[model samples]
Every structure is written in structure tokens, then in C-alpha cells.
Target chain A: MRDDEEMGRITLAQVAQKAGVSISTVSKVLNGRQDVAPPTRIKVERLLETHAYRRTARSSREAPLIEIVFHELDSIWALELIRGVENVAKANQASVVLTESGTRHSPDPDWIEGVLQRRPIGVVLVFSALPQAVKQQLRARSIPFVIIDPAGDPDPDVPSVGSANWTGGLAATRHLIELGHRRIGIITGPEDMLCSLARLDGYRSAMSMAGLETAPELIRFGDFHVEGGYDRAMEMLSLPERPTAVFAGSDLQALGVLEAARVNGLRVPHDLSVVGYDDVQVARWSSPALTTVHQPLRQMAEEAAQMLLRLRTEEPSSTRLELATSLVVRKSTAPPRAD
Target chain B: MRDDEEMGRITLAQVAQKAGVSISTVSKVLNGRQDVAPPTRIKVERLLETHAYRRTARSSREAPLIEIVFHELDSIWALELIRGVENVAKANQASVVLTESGTRHSPDPDWIEGVLQRRPIGVVLVFSALPQAVKQQLRARSIPFVIIDPAGDPDPDVPSVGSANWTGGLAATRHLIELGHRRIGIITGPEDMLCSLARLDGYRSAMSMAGLETAPELIRFGDFHVEGGYDRAMEMLSLPERPTAVFAGSDLQALGVLEAARVNGLRVPHDLSVVGYDDVQVARWSSPALTTVHQPLRQMAEEAAQMLLRLRTEEPSSTRLELATSLVVRKSTAPPRAD
Candidate 1:
């Protein structure tokens, strides 16, 4: 085979003549264009395998290519995750395609169908909630995929990779509690995301553990954005019983909180305390540097990519890997002042 | 032809028979796998084309995928650029493959070559200065590419999209001059990058315009990183004839300069006026908001993608597009205190 390492380019007519079929029938079967009958398709596939034709560099092959799709492109966190996927794919000599899913309210079914029809190796969905119909379609095709930070239902069988977001949330809340701040406010990400739910759960659990009463009025929903965080913080501060400490679901949100505090003439630590998540680069640079929960983003992304590659090569493993999270004690977190 | 689109598939034997060549010769010519006589190769190609036999997607139709290669994944600026590229790609219905072009000092050429062989639709080079051999290889294959912020000798023919970095530098320097700063210091990115040169040009242009002699000791080289900026600022501030205004090439570097100012008991604007570039999100959030040069990053990226797509479609056009840069006035810049 190495002698003719690249020499086996056979034409469809030769195969068709040998199989006693019209060139059109053979072409239809070989191209996998839907017009062909199943029997004809199978026959052509067998001939293809036996003859060992070389594929063009530009064409999609019988073997699928895995695609990793993300919702946001601006965040360093997303890029790190992508690096992880790339590392794994490189090791396996497999190519991974990346695309942005956009911020549309509904996932485009036509787009999903077109991608799947190309017979990708598998899909590593980044920050998308799979619709039931899409899931059903994938299931029918028996195409393997892994979801990262799915916004909706979590299928028990589908593999997923994420940080210990719940623990991260709990750690952030506990740090505030330990600072003797009873009036703590929370600014959270979109309610639809699983990470947001987990973070909320962690905050609740931490509050419960500290024997603190939950104040529904102290919590506000932000879209995990800087502006959202600022607006939410302003709302919290205007309350008659304001929170002395605030926990933001993301570092961007925390910065927003800081701005809100500044505009209100409140000094950090002396007037307010804050904690954030993801520990992105800006966390350490901002004034009164954000106290954040560090998610092992790079590690998690690498592991997810490796897991997807493994699933492609071996039988699907029944194991799920959850990376750890840690609290970075920065200036944003401090003891409450004696008012 | 539209109605009989399914009839385009034909076999190697038919092509070989029509071209009056052996099946092996036809295979070699089609696959470009082996050395074939030029006449025979051309004959086989014409025969295959005339018969309307389309290459199967499974057969090496060199995959039309394009790759976006970055030099460093950890840099926040790079991440933002990636986001811009992602947004544009999504709109164009194109897939982008991401890869790290390895480290800054010692890029892996072999890794890049292997990727090129995979036959992507095209490539968008981000942040890395590609090696000469790699550029030559791409040229040999006639692969269309677009580069962003290339450091090394970029191919003269490849389309490039970049911000007006030189003008940005001049604006920062001139802003300081307008505010009555006679002694000004500058922090710059890697010396090898064109941006570094452009920024230097801007600084000199502004200083000459202000009738201030370009002092040899006033300029420092930094890696366009926070730590580098901090270290350089500290050195410049401790001088006997310290500068009252410092212009940094990047927002992260500006933050570093601010930190150094704080440690040295110098107040921003009041004691030391600072101007930075790339009005990244952090510039506005910092305690004393940084006045910097704003690069229309989103537009630049979208334009870059459009350029690559045009090239991929074989549309010849200009090799470079220079986007505008504007100065964003903020608290970090102000008039120097008069003794």
C-alpha cells in the first residue's frame, strides 16, 4: 500500500461498469446525494472501500469532522476552552471546526441539519441548550456530541464538561459570610444557563450553612454582562437595607458593581465588598482587584476535547469529569466595617 | 445540468478509457499523488471535466475549511480579535479552525506545515509573524490568506487588515503635548512588530511638532504586557528628570503604568498623565479611567473575514485595508500641574 501510497484514484464509471450499473446510478450512490436508494448506496460504498479511492483535500470524507461551536467570542474564557479542544484534536490527528452560534433566542434547525448532514466526526457544543428536536435528529443519526454549559435539559447519556460552578458559587458566598456581612447581595448570570442555576444553588447552600436568612430582595438577575451588573447593583444599593457585600457571577459583572459603588460614593471594603467568578485576567487588574472563584478553564477545555476524541475512537465511556474550583482572596473581599 | 446534477458521478475506469491511459495513470493524475507526464495529466483532466464527472466529497476534495492561527492564547487583546473574527465568520456561513502558532520566540514550523497540508479553504493569520518558509509553502499551493498584526516578513501579496497604530500613537503623544507636558515618556510593544515602529513614528512626530527634543532615555521597550509596562514605568519614574506624561501602546500596559504610579506616590493626571491604546473594556472600569486610542476591532475583524472570503472566491483586490483609530478621552489624561 505504501508503494502506491497515494495512487489508488479510481473513477466511478469503471466501478459502475464492473457492477453493471449506469454511471448516473453509481454517481448518485457514491455522492450520498439523497436521490439514491439504500441498496445502491450500500453497493457503491462497498466498491469505494474495496478500491480505496483517495479523497480530495477540499471534500468532506466518509469519516466525520468534529465541530466545536461557541456562543461568545470576546471572552478569554471561551478561547481557553477552544485551546483545550484544539490540543486534544491535534493529538488525535483529527481536525476540529469552530463557529459561533450567535445570540438568537432560538437555535436554527436548518443550520444544525446542514452541519450534521456533512457527517461531522462529532460535535462539541459550547454554550448552547440543545432543543429536543435537534437532539432527536442527532440521536437518529447516531452522531456523538458533548455539550458545554447547556442552558436547558441535561441528558443523562450525553457527555458534558464543566467546572465545579456550584462550588465556585458557594465559595464566593461563604467568603462574604465569613467577612461578617449579613446584608449580602447577589448579581447573577442569565437564568436560563445551567452555570447560573448552579451558582445560585451554591449561594443558597452557603447562606443556609451560615444560618443566614435568604433575602429575596437582595438578589438581581444580570445577563452576566458588565452593564447588567451595574444596573443590578444600582437597584440593590437603592434598597433601604442595602447589602454591604456583593457576589457577582462573572468578573465583568463585578467590575460593574465596582463602578456602581464608585458612583454612589462608597469606598471599597470600607463601604462595600465584592466577589466574582472565572478569575479572568481583568480580575487582578481592576482597582480593589476582584475576589473571584477560579475555574480551571484551560484544563476543563482540554479534558472536554480529549473526552470527545476518545468517544470518537472508543466506545462511549460512562464517566463524567468535573474539574475543581478555588477562591482567589483578592482586595475586593474584606471584613465588613463597624457602621 | 441542474436537473441531472445527480448524473455527474463517473468512475476512474471510464476516465482512463476515455483518455487512453491506464487506470493507475488516471489515478495518479487525479490525486496529484505521483509524478505523471504533463501531457497525460492534462489529457486526463480534460477528459474527466468534459464528461462532467465530479469528484466525490469523500474523495480528497481538499477540505474547504479555513484556519485562524493565533500566537498566544492567553493575551486578552488576542481574544477580543478572535471574537471579531468569529462574528464575521458566522455571518458568512463559513467555518474557522483555530490553532496556536506556538510561542513568540520559537514558533513551530512543522506544526504549521502539517495544518496547511490538511487543505483548508483559506487561512487567517492572527498575531503571529509567519516564518519565510511557511509563507513560501502557502504561495506554492496558491492558498489565499489574510494576516492580522503579523510580526515577521509578511508575503507582499497577501491581504492584510490592521488598525492605524502609528496614527494612534501620534494622537496619544499629541494629546499629552496639548495638555502642556514637556517631559514625556513612552512604553512600546515588541520592537520587531510593525506596530511598534508605527507607534514610535507617532511619538517622534508629536514631539517634533511640540518643539520637544526626543530624549534618548525617555523611551522604553515592553512586551505589550502589564508586567513589562509596570517595570518600565517604575524605571522611568525613578529618574532624576522624570516625565510628567507617559504614553503606553496598550491598555494592559497603561494599567501597569498606573500601578507603578500608585506605588511611587504619583497621582494620575495630577502628577502623571497617562494615555494608552486599544480602549479595551478595562480602560473605562479602572478607578481613573484610561484615555486611550480606540481601535475599531469589531469592524476590523469583520472586514478581515470579508477580505479572506473574497480571496477564497478568487476576487483580486487591494493587499491592505487600514482602519481608522480615534482617541478616547478619559480621566487618566489631563493637564500637568504647573509649579
Candidate 2:
């Protein structure tokens, strides 16, 4: 479907005529100018999408730029992703244009206009899902984009990069089980996220395989942030029979668990054991450091950027690339004390 | 001198003639084209510099881009600074171009070429100093730039924004002193950086003011990283008469100190008190949380970005702006336990 332009089957004039608009108006719409009325713009966009009109490769005279859009720039994961894209862009002698826009689902509507006008080599979106309209707009302009979907929910049509969440969860739980912890708790991400559910299922599988009971009271959902981890940990700690070990979903959440334990007068790895996912820099820098799942965020971003560059020249072999997640043994996890 | 171009005191043709180069050659140099010979490029550059040939204000037709160049994007402060610039750039409806280039002192020579062609609205550099040649090129092209100097080293001629390192040092020290800590040690940054010296001095002042002798063994210069903090802290903790509290000069260093104390079987704020500088995210995320100095890194970057915009329309009222730092008391510090 993306190759219709390779056959030279569509032209701007044809799209303009079909949309009942002037060639200049079509050009304006293509450039994302706001002057065009909504109706006309929608009509032109539909025509372009139907024809799959891919813009020609950018001229060499323009400085090569790669655009990376993030819904939330404040995320702890932002730096790793930016560095990944930056690494690839630098290697290609291209600069990175960063935009913080939109919700977790898609970029803001206004963002597309600037992107169209800039005519970057490609775009890398740190979003779980791309709005269909936005996807069509980018596809019509031949702006190849790949989503760095750390959330593990990949749209089948869009090329995406994610990590092995289930494997990460299985390994984390198995490590604790091997250390002779029978009653282990799991604090996964929001219930709505696929990664969280995947991790939870992995934990449940590990517990069942080890002949241990999966107690409902020992399972919880978290916001994947520090405060949420602390709150959930405190609740479990107050239980009459609290779990001896916990898998704290994300590194930020893991820090909260560490703090919660401190507040509860329990020493990490001695009175309680905590494991975090996402081996972000903070994982290593945390007080006792954290035993975490290495989600390969940077490598995932690098792969996404590389995939965008690849899509520009050739058809992708696969639309989804799920990298492996490994366990990192640090200071946070240990055997539960004898009664 | 910057107003010479506004007064139309120089022309490209005249500069080309003076340099004995063709107008086209001068134009290529202006565009940062690499085809020109070294001698010709330098000759044309000198003539342009002599005449103060500021390129006319960029055409509004071009995309408004704000460039931010960092020598090391891996620094923990990078995110805060990027957020600050991103905040301002978004407000102005300008996209941000991020470049990781050069060293701590200046950007690489090749970096200027792309900047020349991109012709961003302005540039915000995250470096302690800019080479004379790079400064000349930027000035000749009328591309205003401001440095975000967290290192506390500001070139006299360049507009820069920095924080009050000395004051931050004083605040952290006084917080410890007020907590009844008579014997305190400090782990400041590298000895060469002015900020490190300033912070060390602040610690010294606080100690002297409290009628305490500043022991040579208690003051240690560190690399301002976690490992450095850990090594120095271990050395200090091993002293015959160890400090009751330690002031770690940076958040990363403070993390190291926490680990060191843990290894020594000393509880934070109980067996030992610890205070950190730079209240970065990690400071708050650490097990006990760190009592530290709040360096307004994001604000400093915002000011630098704001300064660049102001430079486009008017001369800066002051070339150097130093934001204040304050103390943030958290869980890390307490009165020294009775020996």
C-alpha cells in the first residue's frame, strides 16, 4: 500500500483535481498551511491517502533533520529515547528536531503541520498508538515513522519496537523463587497497559510452576511511578502476612518500594526484597542500586530510528521488533530471612 | 559593534572584494560550504569579522528553529536543561534542534557549518566556554547564542546563565551545621571547576563560622559522580575521627555516599548524616531522600533561551545572570548520634 508512489501512479495535480481544489490549494494543504478550510483540507487529505501519494525524497540542499515527537517530555524514559535517536541521527549527519506534544495516544493535531513543512527525513514517535488520520497524513507525504512502543501495545499496521515484557517478568519472579521466596508479590503497571498484564501473567505462571499459590492480596496495580510504588508497598507491608519479595514493575516504582521499606523500618534485601523493571540510570544510582529488568530502552529507540531510515529505502521485513529483556542482579534483591 | 550591521555599514560584495575572493566564494563561506579552500575561507571570515557583517534577519518563510547544543547529553542535568529550553521554544512556536557535539569547552568545528545553513531563531549552548573562532562565526552571521553554564565558568564576553554555586554550598553546609553537626566532611566536584571550588569554600565558611576547625583530611575533591562520591566517602568514613555528617556536592555523589554508609553498616541520619547538593530527581528518589541544595538548572536554561531571543531584538542588559540556590531539607540529614 505504501508503494503506490513507487509506480508513479499519483500526482499533485490529479489529487487537486479530484478534490475539486486548485493545484496551489492542494500544495498549501500538502504543506500543512492553515489557510485551507477544514472541509477542503479533509477532502484533499482523503484524495492523497486514497492515491497513496508519496512525496519525492527531499533535496540534498536542505539540511537533513529527523523529527522525534514525545507525548510527555517529563517521562524518565525520555532521555534514553532521545539519546538513541540522537545517536542514529548523528551517524547519518542529520540533526534531531524534538517536539513535546499530544497525549499518550497520539501527537497534537497542530504538530503535523510543522512536520509537513519541515519535510524531515523521517520521524520517530514515542507513542503507543498513532491516530489513523495522523498516520494517513504522514504516509501520504512519505514521512516514514516508527513507534517506540515501550507499552507493548503495537498497532499491527505500524512498524514498532518493544521489549519482551513477559520474559522480563518471568525472569524477575524466577530469580526470587530460586532464592527460596515462596510468597512473592507483584506490583505491575496500570491494568490497562498490555505490558503490565503480560508481566503479571508471567509472574503468575512462575508462581504456579514453582507450586506456590498466587494470592489475590499479593497482586497490585501501580502507576509506574515512585509514589505509586511507595503507596502499594506500604499497603502490602501493613498486611498480617506480607509477601517476602516484590516485583516493583518499573525502576521509579522500585525506588518508592525502597523508601516505603525505609519508612516501615525494614531493611531492603534483609527484611524485604524488591525488584524493579527498566534498568534506567537511576536503577544503578539508587542507594543499594536495584535488581531490575533491562528493558533496552536506548537500543529500542536506536532500532526504531534505524527502522525509519530502513523504511525510507526498502519495505520492512517485519512491522514489529520485540527486543529481549534481561535481568540485572544488583543490590536490591535477596533471600528472605528465616522466621 | 553588533549594531554595525543594523546601520548597513558592511556589504558582502565589499567584503569579498576586500578579501580578494569572488562574491560566490564569499557566499559559500557564509553558507558554511566546505568546498572553499582553508585560506580563502579564513580570509573571507576575517574580512567579514572586521566589518561586523551581521546577516540580515532570517526570512519568516523559513521554519523557526531553536538550536540547543550539548557537549555531553548524558549528564543528569541534561534533561532539566532540555525541558527548560523545550518549554520556552514551545511557547514561541519554534521547534528545537538538538545537537550533541564537541567537548566541555566548545562545539566541534564542523558543527558551525550546519548551524549556518539551518539559521535557527537562536542557539542555546551548554558549554562552559566557546572558542574564539566559533564565537566570531556566530557573531558575523548575527546568530545570537547564550551559554547555560552550570559549571559556574562564564566567558566574560559571552552572555551566559549560571547558578549560585557558592551560595548553594553555603546553604548545604549551614543546614548540616544548624543540625548540630560539629565534625562535617564535604565531597565537592573536580578541583579545576570554579563551581567545585566555590562550593568547597562555602563549606569552609560554614565550618569556620561555627567555630570548628577545617581539617584537611575532611575536605575531598571528587569527580562529581556516584563512584567518585563512593570512593571519597569510604576514605572519609575510615578516618580515626570521621565526620559526623558529610556534604556530598552533587546528587550523584550523594547516592555514592549513601551506598558507602550502607556498606559501613551506618544508617543515614542515625549513625551518620548526609547532605547533597543539586536536588536532582535522583536526590528525591534515593532511599532516605537527600537533604540538598536546590540548583535551578531548568530556570537557568530557560533564562539562557530567553536571552537568545532578547538578543535578536535588543542588546542584553546584562551578559551574565546567576540564579539563586536554596536548601531543601529532606530525609537524609539529622543531628549526629551521641557517640
Candidate 3:
């Protein structure tokens, strides 16, 4: 029994060394990353199974369970996204592990290492803007995974899931436009984020569609947080020719916009029309109820979890899933009048 | 090299078997959990060191990491509580592992086993109404843990951290009394929770202090959710002798109160005053900012994490730490008007 236990505990590095492949290739095989060649992948996988095969905590004797790795970046928005993911994981009986990629000051590598060492059937990368080099490392290891909101370009073969961010942005802009607002302003997330760019594109597209010129002064940047939104809104509202309508990239930012409006004695929809994206729970409860675009957060999370599960099970990857978005017309938005 | 690798991998289970002790005793020795006799504990520790026994992951190499297990009871309010815990855990350089305790229908023991096998330095239980038998099991294992908003009495030695619920209730009720409100209502959380009981006690105490009679019709039962708060608030307001002020146990519930007020055409602080507990982020942003008892959520989480860390480190367990609470005067509360 002791000998069996000792021999059964094979580290991935040892398997990689013995197979005359990079640790990544061995990882790719173990993770069922489909980019690898069939013969080489099979050989490595066979070796892995023979050496350290262990069923996942959720899996039956035959089926392997994928693990969803949630890296919460200090945001309450992550919680809603997690609920969406957990709902899907529970339905599928796949195991999910939640961890925080420590705050910006001290980025610990232990979280990543722990997930890798666990050798989960597959992984779902949730809200991780992992550096390119780290992403490359993960790819090289051929860790079967799908990025929900990855910082980099999506792999052609690996499945990815996200909302129709650009459309949502356009919808938010159009809502203000339909309210007869020409002098519309926009507050967006960090410029580096893909969603931020996509949302901005949507806003510009909507403005152009209305034959309205974009006002350079009306645009501002926020870090996709309530405080960031609040500060940026303050800056925008303080301008000489303040915008009549404000489009915020997130609901939290919209709240900030509301606060800024209140501080400036601007009545919502009466003095300032505001539209927000990601219509999180706060949107419905906030006073004047935020007019916003609803990101199919739950659907996106569920699809991503399913995609990761398929990858872990060595099933064929599905095409990228782009969920739809819709505008939830609420009291926060109104037509701009000649005040 | 293979033989050396094999020789170095000695699981604690092996050490426990060899030393003729329970896995709990071996774990206690490894983690320095001090309930065990000094001699037996030292014997196990010596065996582990002599054999060069290593924990499965490198997590063991670092100072013990604590886990804040969120017993997700399908309540959104838990999200803010988690945020509080995460903030503290991050500040302390301790990693938090989030796990969903099964709901009423799916009670699985595997969740507990998974956390235990990981050998977390300690655990911070949040809002989990764990059964007494399970608590006994945890106690028997001698795992150092702290329960936050626990549903039942924890082992005497295991420390707990929570807000001053009784005081919060009193503060809310007194705020109403000062407003010349004779008929005030209360919306409470689940009957089984200790916090709910404390909050009820405070409300009763405040009414007694004010020489005001408690109206049976004014008290309503809620599940500490927005919908529950909303329904209960509606019920209270519909009464012939309606309450002039309503104190809710949670912010989510308070939101429901606001909705109820809106539906009933009641102007806040004009016709009805509302006070809520645990001033979550939404409380500040709500239309008429909520007048709430600010439960030091972040501080409570930090204190709980600190307590768990101390317990895991073989330090003497301190008696329960009761964090302070304060009443945040906001737009939601005001003096009751004479009809």
C-alpha cells in the first residue's frame, strides 16, 4: 500500500521529463488542449493516465470533471458573474474553485500554481486579465481552458464566451439619442480592456448613425468601478459645456454619474439623461432606476463553464459563443428638453 | 532520481498511521492546532520532520493560509459580507477559498472533506447554518475556526466575530422614537439565526426605553432579502394603524422597504422613515441614501480572519470579539409628522 501510494504520486514535471516533451506539452495533453497533434498528445495522455490518474472530486469513475477557476478582481460585479458560472457548474455537476488573484500591490503566483498542480479536468478562466507571458505559459502547457474575459486575443481553436459589448454600448448611446439628446457624453472602463474598446466603438457607431459629431471633451476614462465612475462623471459634469446625456460603461459607473448629477443639482432624465451597461442588481434598485443594457452575464458564465467542461472531457471545442444584449428601459433615461 | 522523488513524498496520513494517532491529531501537530497533549503532538511532529513528509501542494511551505468559506444560502446579501472578508484576507496576505455549502436539498459532505484535506491554516465560516452534528465533527477534528453570523452556538473555545446586532436594533428603534413615532415596525431575518434574535432584543429594549408599547401587527418576518423586506414592509404599511418608521435587518431588505414605500406613494422621511442594518454599498447610492446602522463588515471580517490565524498558529484563543457599530444618519430617516 505504501509503495502504491508513493509510486502513484507522479508530478507533471517528471512526466514531462520522461516523455521527452516540454512541461507545457504534457500539460496540454493532461488538460486536453486540442491544439496539439493527435499522436503526440495521445502518447503523453496515456503516460499521464498510467502514472498519476485520479478522478476529480465531482466526476464519476468514468467521466472526468472540469474545474472552473474564478479569479475575483476586487469588484462586486465578479460576484454576479460567479453566480452565473456556479449555476451552470451545478447543473453540469462540474467542480468550481474560487480564488482571488491578490490585490494589485502583491500579486502572488501561488494561486496559479495551486490550480495547475491540482490537475483539474479542465479550467475556466474567469475575469482574469493575466499578463501575456503568463497566458503563453498556460497555452504552452496546453491547459484545456476557456477565457471568459481574457485580456488577449482569443485562440482560434479554443472556445471563448463574452457579451455583445459593442452592441450594448451602441444601444446605450441610442437610448440617449432617441431621447433627442445630441450632446451625449461617455464614460468607459480602462482603455486597455477589450470590452472598453468594444463599448467605445459601439458608442461612436451609434453617434455616427445619428449623424452627430463626437465631442472630444465629453469622453472620459474610468477603471470600471463605482469610485472611478464617480470621479470621471464629476470631471465630465464640471466641464464648461457639460453633456446633456451621459453613457456609462457599467452600472456601477452609472451610479457614480447619478451621484455627480445630484451633487450638481441635476435631476435625472429631467436635467441629465443617463444610460448604463451591465444592468447589475443595483440598476433596478437605484433611485430613478437606471436605464441600462443588460449583459447576458449568467448565460455567458454558463456557456463558458460548459465549454471548459467539454475541453476537460477531450470533446471537440464548440464555436465561440457571443450572447445577446438588450436595453432595459427604466426611469433613469429620458428625452432631453430645451431647459 | 525517481526513487529519491518517491522517498520524499510522505503524506500525513502515513505519518498518522505510523504514529498510531487519528488523522486529526496528525493534522493538529502539523498545523500546530493545540488541543492535543504536548507529548503526543510533539511525537507526530518529530515523525513528520524525520521522514521529510511534505504537504501535497507548495501551499504548505508558506505560512498557513486561512479560508473564508461562504455558506451561500441563495441570498444576495452574502455577497457584501464576502467582500468584507476578502478585503481583510487580502490585506493580511492570507488566501481565501470560497466554497458554497449545499442548499437544503443537496447536502453533500464532500465540501467539508475537500476543505479539510487541503489543510487550510484555519477557516472563517460566514453565514452558514451548519447542523449541530457537523459542528461536533469539526470540533472533534480540532480544527481552529471562527464563525461569522453563525446559525448555532459554536464550540466555546472556537472564537466568533460579529457586529453589535442588538445595539443596531436599538439605534434604529431609538431613531424612530426620537422622530416622535409611537408605532414603529421591525422586519427581521430568519428565526433561527442568532443575529436575528439579538436584533429583536434590541428593538424590544428600545421600545421599552421609550415607554412605547410594541404593536404585534407592526412586526414582520423576512428572510433577510430584498423581496422579503419589500413584502413585509408592504404588509406593515397597509395596516390601518400603519408604522411611521420601519427598521430592517439587512440592506437588501431595506431596499425592499424603499420599493414598498414607492409603490404605496409614501415619501421617505416625509410619510415613512426607514432604517436598515449593514450599510452595504447600495445603501449610500439608493435614491434617498439609507439611514442605516453601519455594521463594520470589513472590520468584522478582518477580526474573524485575524482570530482564525491566531487559532491556527497555536496562540491562546481569545474570547469573542464584538466589533462596534454606528448609526449613519442619511436621507432615509426623519421625525414622524403628526397627522
Candidate 4:
């Protein structure tokens, strides 16, 4: 039993080396990415089955299972991630178990122990970090875990899946800039989160490139919800020199900003242009329809689940996977009106 | 060990019978629902713990755990339910384990078997049913389960938690009528769902009570989403004599109705009035802030979680728990005008 456990530690690199194919090629097949040639996909799949032969020798019929741990099921964001994970989970016949981390930035040791007891093939943590103690213990048990949008700085050992926040921020800011808006205000997420910092940095860079000075007062930090967006945008719009345009870090926040605009008697696209990030479900449903940056949260989550599965059953590949972002122009943005 | 296992199966009736208190009084203490006299509460709690003093003899340090099973993690609706369950789960020092039943409405035997293997204290099924075979297996093992908003007829054997949908529909339509609107249109959920039929029935009764002839063309069956709501409302509005007010079965559908109105250049509450159900997070944020029936989905979920915990550890209460719903009049409805 101990020897079989040792064999379970086989890495994705080792499988690729043995199969005489690149690690990426092996990953495409395992993730059901559909980009790989059929023959190569077949060969890689055969090798993966053989590699897990000992484990499946007991029973080939039962589907595999994985675990997804979230810090909180706070918003629509969580639903999008769950949808992505389910898409892949269904196709692979692998179940996803959800457990909340209960507001602690570092997970409770007892919760980690419970996960260890379940012995899921792999674990995916969303907007979460692994404390040193828990990380050491997970490694000792030979269980693979991946982080999605880590709360802190990226650690070399932890694999992660996230969208390009900086690029998204840059695109949103540039859209406002090109539309003849110079006095642009930005509402970013919590300062400590990596994605928040990246988005803030992206906004600063765009302002600098446009030869515009980013006023310190124009930037506000928020919790990425409607209330925070409304509060911060109220302050920005209340200033003696109100910005003609605003960029919000989340769709929820942008809706709040719109509320702020309505309360202040400012018309969207006619008096003020607004841009939101993370084109969540209600963005299109909102009146005037929000123009925003598209963050592929669902696809990113699917990739994360796929990555964790590979790490558990096959071998580890290159650690970080950053999905690209794009700008989606809708009815909410337009050129600032003449004074 | 076997003796302790047997003791674990001790029913709440057995506890109440020994404690010399009514089963309901004992239940109040077990669920921490305050109202019992201090002396009675203390006496019941003591007896409850002493009944299986041996169970605590093993270790009472670890918190108890419960399971919540969902049909699919597809919508904001699911997250609200999760949040409600988590609130009670946290207060009771009980952790929640979430499992998705996927496409199969009635869970597979294997899935039920896997849950049984986990040995959870109780289970909460959201919009799900158990096959007779699986139900028998669960009962034989003494594991308790409750259904929340069951999709089919209310089964006597299965305890369930839900809101008063008929009352909600009545309240919404009555609000429109009292606003001086004689002609009202209704859009309901899927035909097979009990809530759908109830809401539709409620609409018919309200129209009858008003001595108004019900128009078959004005009532439409929808899937309870934006697209369906929009399509049905569009159809109703295009009629030669359109209704002055529309009542949508869900907030999503209301948004669809709003979209239809916008496309047709009708101003809400001025040219027409709209009322929605479910009052999800986005309703308050929508343009004109939707008038809706508060379904209490989150509170209903909390009550369901609390009920499941009680069913497992205490004597079961009367089977079905129906929470009350109310109307939240926002900006979407008003008196009809004389053009």
C-alpha cells in the first residue's frame, strides 16, 4: 500500500517525458481542451490510464472526485466560478465538493484535516491562501492543491489560475481616455488582494501613457460590491471638480456608480461615461447596458479545475496560467460633453 | 462502540419522554430557539446531554457537521440558499458540506450511497426528490433528510421548507389592482412546477375576486427568466388592447418585461406598471428599482437548514414549514392614467 501511494506522486512532466510529447500536449487532452491532434490525444490518454492503472485496478467504473474550497460564497462571482468548475467536472465525471473557509484568510487546520480525510484527487481554493503549516501538511500527504486568484503575492510552489487583471484595467481606462474623458475616477477592490493591486497599477499606467496626471483623490478602494461602489462614487462625484467618467472594478460596483449618477442627476453617455469590470450577468440587463472589460472568470475557473486534476492524476506542468482579458463597449460609455 | 452507535439513534421522543417535558419544549432548547422558561430550558438541555453522556464521553470537542445537496449550482438563487444555510451552520458550530446532484433531479443510488458513506448528521435537499429505493435505504440507516421547495407534490413522509407562493402572487396582483389598474397580465413559471401552478391559480382567483373577466390571452406560462419574460410580455403588449400592468413570476423575467417595455418606448409606471417576484439582489439596483414580492429565499433556506438539524438531533416537528412572503412596493408600479 505504501509503495502504491509513492507511485501516486507521479508528475505531469514524467508522463510527458515517457509519452514523447510536450507537457502542454498532454495537458490539452487531460483538460478536454479539444485543440490537440486526435492521435496524440489518444496516445497521451492511454499513458494516463496506464499510469493510474494501480489505483483503478480496484475499480475502473467509479468516477473521480475533486474538492473546491472557497473563502466565502459572497456574490455572483462565486456562482460564475462554480459554473466553470461544473462544466469541466461534468464532462470528466468528477464531482466537485464545496467547503467554505469561514472568513479566515489562512484556512483552519481542522478544515484542511477534513479535506485530507476525504482524500479527493485534488483541491481547488478560490480567492484563498494556504498558511505555511497547512501547505507543509498538504505536501507531506502528497495531495495536490491549486489556488485561484490568490489573496496575496504568488508563491512559487502554488499553482494558480487568474485572468489578466492589469490588462483588463488598462483596457477599461484606455476606452475612457480615447472617448475624450480626462477626469476619470477609478474604484478598485481591496488593497491587499493581488488582483486589486494589479488593476490599480493598470489604471495608473494608462493615465500616465495618456499624459494625464492621476489625481490621488480620484482613486478609491472598495470591497467590490454595489454598496462600496455607490459610497466611493458618491464621494468622487461630490467633489467640487467631479470626474466626467468613472471605471469600477466590478459590475456590481458599476451599477452602484450608475445609482450615484442617477442620484446626482447625471445622465450616462450624455453627461458621464462609466465602465465596469467582470461582465457579470446583470451588466447587460442594467438600463443603458454597461460598457465594461470582460474578465473570463468562468473559463479561468474551468482551467483551474483542469489544472488541479492534472496535478493529482498526472504530473505538474508550468505553474501559472493567466487568461487574457478584453474590452466590451456597450451603451454606458461615450465622449464627455462640452462644458 | 456498538452500544454508542445504538445510543446515537436515540429519538427526540425518547429524550422528551425521559425529560418529563413536552417534545416541543425540548425541541426549542435543542434548536436554541429561545422562549422556554429558564428552569425548563435548563432541565431539558441537561437531560438531552445526559441521554447519551457516553456519546460525549468519546469527545464533544469537535463540532457536528451537516450536508446540503443541490440540483445544480447554476444561479444567484443557489448562492442565496447557500448563504442562508451557512449562517445557521456557523452559529451552531456545524460545518456545511455541499454536493451537487447535477442533471438528475432524483439523485442516483450511487450518489446517495456515497453520501451515506460520509455519515453526515443530516441532509438538506434543495428542489430535489429521493427515489423510493434510496429513501428506504436512508430511513433504514436512521439518517434524516429534508426537501426545500420540492419540485413535485408535497409528500407526507418528506419534511419540506418553502414560502407561500400563492399569497405572494395574490399580493402582487392586488397591489396592481389597488393602484387603479383594471387590466393586469401575468407571467408564471414552468407548468409542471407546483409554485408555478399556485401562482397562476392565485392570479385567477384575484381576477375573479375583482369581478373582472380573466383574459386567456393575457396569461402566459414562462420558464421564469429574462428571455421568456421578455418574449411573453412582448406578445401581451403587442395585442390590440394591452394590459396596463404586468406581473412577472420572477425578478429575472421582470427585467425581461422591462426590456420589452424599453424596446417599445413605454415608460414604466407612466405608460405601464410592472411587478416582479423573488426580489433577488438585482431588483433594487435595476432602473426604476423593481416592485417585487419578497419570496424570502434566504430566510427559507435558513429555516430549512435549522429544520434539518432539528430532525436529526431532536424529535421531528410537524413536517412542513412554510415561511411567509410579502410585497415590496418600489418604483415599478403606479395608478393607471386617463390618456
lDDT of 2 by residue, A244-268 (tens): 9999999999999999998988988
Clash pairs, candidate 3, are A24-A141, A28-A141, A28-A142
**How close is chain A of candidate 4 to the true chain A, as a TM-score?**
0.79
Winning model by DockQ: 2
Model 4 per-residue lDDT tens digits across residues B231-296? 999999999999999999989889889878877878787888999999888898887789999988
Q: Write the per-residue lDDT of candidate 1 for residues A1-339, one digit (tens) a residue.
A: 564446455677877876678888875554434576656655666665556543332243222356777666665467667777777766765656777664533245445644543456677776545665455445434456777652333456667776788888899999999889888888888887777888888999999999998799987788877888899999999999899999988888998888788678786767899998888788888766789999877777777776766765575654556778999998887889886
CAPRI accuracy category, model 4: incorrect
Task: Give the TM-scores of the predictions, in the order they appear.
Answer: 0.77, 0.97, 0.71, 0.74
- Model 3: how far residue B245 lies from native, Å: 4.1
lDDT of each: 0.73, 0.90, 0.70, 0.76
Predicted candidate 3 versus true structure: per-residue lDDT over B1-339, tens digit per residue: 786486675677888898899898887655434478867865776676556564544354333345555656235545655656666665665445556566632235555555545556667776444565345434434456777752333345547776677888898889888878888899988887777888888999999988888988887779887889999998988899888889988888898898788778787778889898888778887757789988876677777777776665454464667777889989888888876
What TM-score does chain B of candidate 3 reach? 0.76
For candidate 1 chain A, which ten residues in a row score worst on lDDT? A54-63
> DockQ, per-model, please?
0.27, 0.82, 0.18, 0.19
TM-score of chain B of each: 0.76, 0.96, 0.76, 0.80
Clashing pairs in 2: none
Give, for candidate 2 chain A, the lowest lDDT window spanning 10 residues: A1-10
Which DockQ-derived CAPRI band holds candidate 1?
acceptable
**Model 2 chain B worst lDDT window (10 residues):** B1-10
